[model samples]
Target: MDLIDTHQHLILRDHLGYAWTDTLPALQGDFTPADYARLSHGKGVIGTVFMETGVDDADYQAEARLIAGLVGKGGMLGQIASCRPELDAGFDDWLAECKILSVAGFRRLLHVVPDEMSQPEGFRRNIRKIGAAGYTYDMVFHARQLGLAEALARACPDQPLVLDHCGNPDVAGQGFDAWYRGMQAMAALPHVWLKFSGITVNCAPGTASVALLQPYADAMLALFGPERMIWGGDWPVVNLGVGLPDWIDMSRALLAGLSADEQALIGHQNARKVYRLPA
Candidate 1:
């Protein structure tokens, strides 16, 4: 089935600054659209949502603008721009700017911030504005922070939220039961959706096979079903584990037993709906 990767990250070291990449030698250089096009070629990928690469705080808008220029090229459908809802000042103006750029949604790296950051009234209030503006909020947090994720979803019931990376499960250590319970709670909320990406990075080295990831994949399928679950490449970060092409192959294998329509839903259909991509 053709795919619309909902969680593709692009790194342009020249136009942006990513201090976080200093520590990770594997992701140090630039990962341009051309690079993605080359890697994803012949992999059934037709479109992509350019997920923010967690640039420095000052570079968020520049990062968005950078991706905006590349949107129509290399199957880049749109972007999930980085945001800071904790600060209310200029939030709406920023949303207006992103709207002009045709951003698909917004994301804040909750895993890197304090747990209490999302609990504040100001944060919740600004997040509501995102929904009010007709944008989805992508939640990227650790597995331990699932409750926090669910609480944020509860606080902003009207906002559409996406749980990234299968809730960033601890597949390497087999932390399944706790993760499942957390995911189940999040799944109970109809407004929340799940992204079937980044699991390979959570697995131990050389152990990211479909056989190992099947249980987690099955649990996600069970929790969110086909309509609510979407696929992602996770790209250079995914390279830390199985790389993009291998992950795509593995994802296809896991979904091989399902009907063609079911595979299409998770692969591209749900993404088009969830991210509101043009048909």
Candidate 2:
């Protein structure tokens, strides 16, 4: 079966001011839908889900409008537009607008925030908004912040939470004890899911081997199993290491040991179910 990439991103960098936007010069330029199209042909990229770019906060609706317009015409596929769960005032109204546009979900930058941010009553309250609206939450946090993901999952109660990049394991040649333990804890929470994406590009060069990543993937598959897992390219951001095809190759190599059904779930079915994309 053809694969579906669940967590690609398309945004103008200057527009996002992503904390690490300039981490690599290769990603400085726009990675638009046209770019995705060029790389996806013959790659089994049957569909995709565009994650938030952390761009201009004021343009949430504008971004939603842009995403819906593009995907409506099949520029890419589905999208998870940006929303700051930390903000107050008119958030409900903003969320209502997004719902009208059919955005997939929401996200907040947890790694950059203080550790205490996750415990904050206000932040938790904001997170609950997604559950209230019946949306998923994309959590971008470090290994240390995995504890925060646990807390966030408990706080939301109903929202389906996804941890990006496998807790961004310190896979740069370091042991993955911390990330594994974290995934185990988070996976126990039935409402949350794990996103298999971005870590390779996010990690430092030559830090981890495919062998190391296997354990992390295994732990998640054992816990959440394939049904709760999803695929993501982390695109342009993935530009830091190998490009899309290489990431897909790495994904296949790592998943080679799994059953066909499990492989189907991780590569496409799980993403479709969680993100509510068209089949």
Candidate 3:
């Protein structure tokens, strides 16, 4: 089946600043659109949404513009640009720029920052502004930070929010019950969605096999159902452990029991709906 990758990441060394890469050894170099295309070819990747690589604050706009310009250069469907709502200075102007570039949504790397930062009045207010403008927000938080995710979802009830990496659960460490409960709580909220990506990257090395990833996938499929769930390759990050092709096969194995339509909903349909991608 063809797939629509909703959480794909790309790296451009010359144009964007990925200072975070110093510690991320597995992802230490350029991963351009051409690289992704080579891997995605015949893997059923019909289209993709470019996810931000958490570049330096100064490079946010440049990165978004660069990625946005790539939309039709390849099979890119759209981009989820990076934004800092808490900065609160010139944010409206920045949103106007995003609109001009035709970005599909925005993301702030919540996992790397202090939890308190997400709760400030400035952050909440800006998030509301983003929602009012009809853009989805990708909440990239760690497993322990689901409370923050819940709070943000509540604050921006009208904003579409997506929980990445199955809430970054520690499947290798067997941290299932806690994450499962967290997923259940977050799913209860009407506007929150979950992305079925990044499981291998979050699990302990050497422990991210298909068998291990299945439970987490099943739990998400059960709680969020096909409509509330979307799928992505997570691209270069998947190279850290189970590479893209293997990860795709593993995802298929985990979701083996679903019918064709249900599989399509998780793999493609839901992404277009959640991210407001073109048909």
Candidate 4:
């Protein structure tokens, strides 16, 4: 399969500041592009977009500059940078810097932050600016928080939004019932897209099985369809559960019934168009 991994992480322990890694001992080391290349060597990754690893607040610009410089490295296509949208007055200046970098979009880790963080007036205001600037923003929300994500997307209908991790559904604990409903509600909006990433981390130990994932995968395809769907490796993070190759194999299994063209869309084509990558 020809893949374009839209959510890979290149963790630089010394060069970059990842405050979040200190809490999670498993992800404390470096995951450079070379390491990723070796692991996914034969997985057929044709391109990739480097995702931010939740660096310290003060390191946002430095991290963006570092990741932005990695555009042509390995198979990297662009950077999905970190940003503080709630900084009402300073956000404009921050966004101006984003415009100057080689960025395809921006992502703030909403799942880990306070729920009210995304609901404030300042956050919404900045999201509007991102849309007006013609950049797509990625929403990383848990299943229970899907309502907040839906509201955020609805508040800015013009902004192109991508819901990361299949709404980050609780495939391990609650099954797919609640996530399915939330997904249906969000997919009703025309500007939304669903990213099929991060499924491994949330699934039960033995239940990363095809049987458990296939149903949820089918629902996403049925609701969002190929045109609004995209795939990502969610690397090093994928290391928390399954490795890159295993996840890719499982993704292929879950998407077995999809046509060749549909597979292409989920794997790379849709990502190319959404991220505006080179042909």
Model number with the top TM-score: 1
Model 2 / residue 175 / CA error / Å: 3.7
* Better model by lDDT: candidate 1 vs candidate 4: 1
Tell me the lDDT of model 3 at 215.
76
The sequence of per-residue lDDT tens digits that candidate 1 reaches over residues 57-111 is 9999899987888888777889999998988788888999998786999999999
| Tens-digit per-residue lDDT, 14-104, candidate 4 | 8878877777767877989989989888887899998887888888778989888788878898989888897776778878888778789
Task: Identify the leading candidate in terms of lDDT.
Answer: 1
Residue-level lDDT for 73 in candidate 2:
55
lDDT of 1: 0.91
Residue 142 error for model 4, in Å?
0.7
Error of 2 at 267 (Å): 1.3
Question: How big is the positional error of residue 25 in model 3, measured in Å on the Cα after superposition?
Answer: 2.8
Error of 2 at 118 (Å): 2.4
**Cα error, candidate 1, residue 47 (Å):** 0.6
Per-prediction TM-score to the true structure, in the order listed? 0.98, 0.91, 0.97, 0.97
Candidate 2 has an lDDT of 0.76
Task: Tell me the deviation in Å of residue 15 in model 4.
Answer: 1.5
Per-residue lDDT tens digits for candidate 2, residues 1-279, read 457776878866544444456666776778888888788777777787778776655666577777776775543557787776666876788788887676878887678767877787887888888777877788888887788888888878787788888678776746477778888888888888888888786457654346657776777678788788888888877777677877787888888888889888888888778777775
Q: Rank the candidates by lDDT, best first.
A: 1, 4, 3, 2
Q: Positional deviation of 135 in candidate 4, in angstroms?
A: 0.6
Lowest summed lDDT over 10 consecutive residues: which window, candidate 4? Answer: 204-213
Candidate 3 stretches with Cα past 4 Å from truth are none
